[model samples]
Target: MAMFRIFLGAVFAAIAIYTIITGTSHGWNLVPVFFGDMAAMNWPGQFNFDFFTFLLLSGLWLAWRHHFTPAGLLLGIIGVFGGMLFLSAYLLVASIRAKGDIAEIMLGRARASAIGKQ
Candidate 1:
């Protein structure tokens, strides 16, 4: 758990720093470039599509973890758009909140508690 927390922390920091640098240089207009790459159908486009799928999966999982409540749905959208910047921070907080319980981290509090009761 300690190691997991450290890993999440490192991911959050690294991605955050990288994002800042990239955004500063690129002017933060990522949508066109991202979608344009996909339209181009090249290696960068292929990679972007793959990464987009992963982000979509991440968003769906987050929504499912929260049982798709309004807040969960909102978080799902944010997860897709915010990408690792949102996810790393979210996982770090969830890990602490779950007290290192992997099941709780994945399943959320209510679901994890219900599973335990069974």
Candidate 2:
């Protein structure tokens, strides 16, 4: 599990680097596209909303794990400005913190049940 997390972290880090270079070169015009591009609105708008929902869910999960202040705020920043690159990286680190405990990795300590999937 640790090895897998490390691998994911490395991959996400690489993706983040690529995104940085590409987005910088392209000026990262998400604001205009998100607000004014009506002709190209359908897919982009839906994707944006869905991705934002994931970001909120990720933040909520982090807060549930007792990282309310910093983690939740950082999740929003990274989600809105950085994208999946940071979230994947965050999840990788979180998996390492779980320390080979699949249950802990899959379900946060506060939510993991001792009995079954009930």
- Model 2 lDDT per residue over 1-118, tens place: 7578777878897897887898898878767765554346687777777776776676666555554567656665555555567667766766777776777765666556543467
Worst 10 residues of 2 by lDDT: 108-117
Give the Cα lDDT of each candidate. 0.95, 0.67
Judge candidate 2 against the unseen true structure and give its global Cα lDDT, from 0 to 1: 0.67
Quote model 1's TM-score. 0.97
RMSD of 1: 0.8
Per-residue accuracy of model 1 over 5-42 as CA lDDT, tens digit each: 89889998999999999999989999999999999999
lDDT, model 2, position 70:
79
Alpha carbon lDDT at 118, candidate 2 = 75
What's each prediction's TM-score? 0.97, 0.64
What's model 2's lDDT at 50?
Answer: 74
